[model samples]
Target chain A: MSRVDVGALVDEARAGRPLAVARLISLVEDESPHLRAVAEALSPHVGRARVLGLTGPPGVGKSTSTSMLVSAFRARDLRVGVLAVDPSSPFSGGALLGDRIRLHDHTTDPAVFIRSMATRGQLGGLATATPQALRVLDAAGFDVVLVETVGVGQSEVDIVSLADTTVVLLAPGMGDGIQAAKAGILEVADVFVVNKADRDGADTTVRDLRHMISLGRRELGPSWRQPIVRTVATSGSGAEDLVTALADHHAWLVSTGALGRRRAARARAEIEAVALRELRARWGGVRASERLDRLAERVAAGALDPYAAADELVG
Target chain B: MSRVDVGALVDEARAGRPLAVARLISLVEDESPHLRAVAEALSPHVGRARVLGLTGPPGVGKSTSTSMLVSAFRARDLRVGVLAVDPSSPFSGGALLGDRIRLHDHTTDPAVFIRSMATRGQLGGLATATPQALRVLDAAGFDVVLVETVGVGQSEVDIVSLADTTVVLLAPGMGDGIQAAKAGILEVADVFVVNKADRDGADTTVRDLRHMISLGRRELGPSWRQPIVRTVATSGSGAEDLVTALADHHAWLVSTGALGRRRAARARAEIEAVALRELRARWGGVRASERLDRLAERVAAGALDPYAAADELVG
Candidate 1:
């Protein structure tokens, strides 16, 4: 489609047309040249849904836990949007696209919309255009948008800043339960889940988590206590507790006027991410070699330092 | 230190002062204000290091393998630089800061420089200032700079464009080995290492790797073949073979002019990454509230779609 067509499609989608929204998300994600137009068209109708990020080390039953959460939110009769951020397929250069396999139970349910996203060569955990996609979901009237990132390393932590509320999931009996505390997991978690709690270490995990929370309380002035919830997602056990924890967190957010603060922070982050992406792409299209060669020559000669060379190149 | 002092320190490091280089790397990784000056001063003496990025799923023995590789390089009397990227802390707002612990053996070896970098809340797998710090290592006379990303999601794939050669490490008995292959591991791997090959499924893992390699060969040209190396990193068994494989990759790079190509690509990617980061940080600081409030209104009113709105915000 022409760039103009992409723009119009986004405009139509913003006007309460679901098909348009879906198509637009596909286009933006595909990174057709028309993405700019489409984003412009849809810009007016986005941003009401609560964006919750679910992240942790893999094998933590994030998908299963996420499925249970989706089900729980659905039982409340809320329209739910799930964005499973998978690792991209090297062959196709797109997301591995396995959310459907994990969330098979929800495929037939119309109230639930699941979209899988790949970084598609974007640097961050979420795709560069994800904020745009979340907007489309929000504009579509979905009550909650769950972003499930490929939870491997720091990407899980990166995803937290992008969401309104961040839920970090951990499975029992794995080294990750202790890792969750060391890898800065405790800081970003608004709500924590120890999934597959039927396992042997569930109790110890809970005790350890409570101890960690107590430690955090010492420095955070009672204002930043992280809540822990237990779940056996395979049987959908403890799902209710998770939902209740979410509600309580939401309540806390509203009561403390943190909701607006959270949203504002996200918006700012989004803007920065986009701007940086644009600048990078632009720089990539320019005289990169000439600049590098000059810098390299000076660096090799011991006349100029590497850091200074970078500033000069950017300047 | 004043920015001028930072600049002079970087300059001294560029002139081959070891202590100055270490101090400069710390400033950059920590994002201290002094970093800007160091970067500015060292800009000329950077980009010479042959960057090698190693990424894999957790428990793939990436760390142990890395330690072994560093030792191997040091054995050849080559100066080595290691950057181990971990997730940054949310509450402390700091990175885990444990590069020394991970490569404890290298602490006393002056020829081996190990820097532990936290994701520092950067969206991408690599931190915002990583390239700069790596440049410092390069300019400081390290012949090879090994970059270990917090391999989490699709973002890890970017390492291919950043390193002179990219190695994807895997362990035996992980059911997800095939899944990882399908998830883009095969595409980025210039050299694949079946680390911890002493395990039971080591042979099977090798066979599976061959099968996956054949599949890739069918689609990609024969020239794109990736060699597999097996190593038990703990006892340093097969470490020599692993080093040989790295040498072979390097030779291939020089013979085919791939070394220049890799360096050029790295320079470009680094530029893109840095540009995006700076733009985002500046934009976040400026457009924080307005973007959020406007987005909230649009979403509430159903006037604009979220994705499109995100696009508009970026525009």
Candidate 2:
């Protein structure tokens, strides 16, 4: 926690010592007492890695695609860091994550690192910690950082919010194309990938996605039209195309000055989250001190409203 | 904002004046500057109504089920208030919500009040506003309040967090049962209804739900076994069964002392959110004063970390 411990740890992490990176991530995930010191040490070494987020519904071959993408990235000799933030995800479920045995192609390669994040006890806790973890990976000298998250609920939104380029993966006949629109992922995706392209409904799914994307462009006005890449991730087919699409999106982000803007927004959110968490702790203390118990009883009795009770506590 | 204005409004709202209740909800949704005064005035006269939350994916016939439930409740002479807090939801989307034209069944009935909420612009803002809106409904002397929210993402979790009993609606094959499970709705539902039971795959869906419920019970340990009700919401079939399930859950909550605990937890969350927002506004000012811009630049250039920068600002 002190400057001394952080200074040494930073050197180790920067040197790409796996132990150092792992420890640093644990500190951030647990919100260690000396996190400020760790952040201070890390601040000087991040922002080098290209952060990519791939998300989709369950059974969408997202993990398979991620694994394939890892291979493609490695083939180009780029060091990669993979963070699976959705542990409950069937894509990266219990059997797939430990040592990433499912990703046998890259497990033996020291050039790649993979980690699975467990659910933080509180809702959105993982969200608050994700960027910091990305920082750890970035500072560790990874050329590319891939965050694979489940594309559902608010958790998915939060997971991808920090990525420089967000790729939404899909498969045919899982009925996810409609679900994607319903969940509003269509708005956030930077690249759309149809995995399992050899399946019976793959072309139909691709057509549906194209239709939605065009509809979206008409509504939002064409900017960077998301390219659809078809792939059979399990067979490693179209891995090169998926990578090219992602790279193209990243290039587009930098060209449009959106990358800088996104980073700024992400930083703003992170700072606010940290500040709010600290403030909430004190606020909880204030509520008990202000006798919110009595106020709550009255509110529960139809004698007072919760808003009025909250006002009294805040005052 | 003054004591006098709040006092008058509270009186009118308690007297069941629809205008007064609507105005109160608007104030809460907007986070009106004079909200403290309004809260103080309406602090009492809430907590009498049983708040029921109905949530499910789009096209699950939530509105139809809600309509049927309203009619059933009215048949028993119970006054009902329906809050459709999903403006984008197919059930309560623009057209269905404006005047609740879809519920022509109850528009003219003096025993019912229906309103739909729009998004509050900020993430979790609607979540923060929803409790206060419920209080307005409760203080307005409605005996039963039905809150219908689209079951997707974090919003649904926040929306249903306040309900005394939560009913999760699912149609035969909108591909939501598994989606719901992935979104963690299974943990929150007190009752599950397979609406559109007249359709194909209805039994299969119900069986899937039952199997999942059994798996959940075995994993989570049995508390109150969530009953799976079959319904054709549009035709009013099984409306009584759904009501009975909800009632049974409510009674069980009371008998087990879970109701008080749940309410306490909900209130705690609400208070913390309020205090956090106030502190965040102040934190924004501090970020500028503490030179977060310079820190962000350093972090961006691989010379500083976000955690360290946040610490300096917090200090």
Candidate 3:
């Protein structure tokens, strides 16, 4: 491939050229050699977009909800970007295809840009790639960037926690309350979204969440109380209420100066992940390193301890 | 604190002194400064124990099943070590208390060792710690070491995948078949246990597992077919059957030479994790680095891209 002009691409992306934006995000995803150049070019135009994260279990209608949110944001004359990240399986292109079908309404809208990303099961792949993709969308002048990840895996949760406002979606009859509590979702969630509210047991789900929030509030002591918004995303029911709740959370974050703290924390994590990835690559990674293989053989044979093996490999 | 004589501790641990074994595991868990000495001292005596991993979602009776296995192993004149690892919450000692209660039958048995470990929510805590603890148990002359991790999180699954024979447990009415598939349990399990077999839906659960197994067998192509054992663990009804299944799996692993492959892979992961941890320590870790904080500030303010900031930090 010929060397691309990253500066020109950045200019075009900033002018809302979708192809340029897509190319920049692809560079991020592929970990291209020009990734540093792309990042450098996109740096100045970043940090203006309000990054929102949506996460839930598999059957929670996350894609439909994301589409609804895009429509809501676009209705307000704001350009929106959606990144559907699947951390569960590297080979599951099924998630992306399902997302495309659900998000068909925004396919032809120039103001809406949607992309799906899979980690390909790389260690810290989502951590390193998602933030860079967000930067690309931000530089492209999107007013809001929504990062939607499936499942409750630690990596997925960590990615969503990077957003300025994190929305945890739950559906009735999924036993999601227990699952959510088990996954420590309450700690990371800034907004609780009870999606698929048209189903039975929705009221109970909402009440259970409210009760859990009350219990948590005692320990948190006068912070932002996560609001439980009920939404039937298929019909766009309660879309306005969900949007208002997000706006309220954002306003609270700005007023309390938590936005800066959250963003700095997110940036800290991204930089560390990138540094670690680069370090691993320098050492030929854990899988392909012959030195690692020899040490592992000795360790497996009980001739050397893992720690000593690690010391030798690092040396 | 006085300096520990790791050599003496190893000698006593190998002599089957419970206190010495406990101290070595504690050293590993605390990431003590003498960790290298402990590892070196225990290295020669490691790699003998048959490591068995038991994992499932909560309410599948994992602790009860582990206790039953301990009884079965001890009945055959083998020393058993149990490590109850809870990856869900650092502060939740509830799992340990519950495990102790369920395992009360072996509380006074000298041949049975039980330890409960929490990661304290540390990054890669389980990845680096569990194997070292396994070494401690192995060096202490345990014939069988059972690593029981609660939940089906990625880290929990990764830890279990290190074992020679991994058993995934499920109870009737838990919707665990779907949960297991979602967590990629199908790929890791060497044996499947349908615990709480006396409950309703046990037959359906077993049939569902059999169907899933058949579907998976096409890709696996005549490898070890995971045997499904039904047991009411509370009554120890099928404890002998479960034990026989484990023995069969171990035999298969030895015959196919997969045991050596699995152990080497486990060692590879351990050595790589230790090397990365040491490297992170050298850089004062991602959490405590002043350089990282400065770079994060710049990146958050849009003055620098994360990739460029990472390059500076790594340099």
Reference contacts preserved by each model: 0.30, 0.41, 0.64
lDDT of 2 by residue, B1-315 (tens): 533376778788777777888788888777788677666566556667888999876557787888889999999999999888754443444343432555776967877888777543455566677777777787788999999876655556777888999998888875545555544677788899999999999988898888888888877667798999999977889989888998899899999998887776667566655655554555558556357666556557656566555666667
DockQ scores of all models, one per candidate: 0.32, 0.30, 0.42
User: In candidate 1, which residue ranges exceed 4 Å CA deviation?
Assistant: A2-21, A33-45, A88-102, A124-127, A152-155, A284-315, B2-18, B30-37, B40-48, B88-103, B122-127, B218-220, B277-315
- Give the TM-score (0 to 1) of chain B in model 3: 0.94
DockQ, Cα level, model 3: 0.42
TM-score, model 1 to reference = 0.84
* Per-residue lDDT over A1-82 for candidate 2, one digit per residue giving the tens place of the 0 to 100 score: 4434767887887787888888888888887876777777777677678999988875577777888898899999999998
Which candidate leads the pack in lDDT? 3
Compose the digit string of candidate 1's lDDT tens values, residues B1-315.
544476667567656567887788777766687766666566656656778888777667677777788888888888888776633211112323353355567766878777776553556426456777787887677899888864545555665456888888888987555566666667778998898899999999999998988877867676656888998877788888877787888888889877776665565556445545554454456465466567645544545444455556566
What DockQ class does candidate 2 belong to? acceptable
Query: lDDT: which is higher, 1 or 2?
Result: 2
TM-score of chain A of each: 0.86, 0.91, 0.93
- For the second chain, the TM-scores of the candidates in order are 0.85, 0.90, 0.94
TM-score ranking, high to low: 1, 3, 2
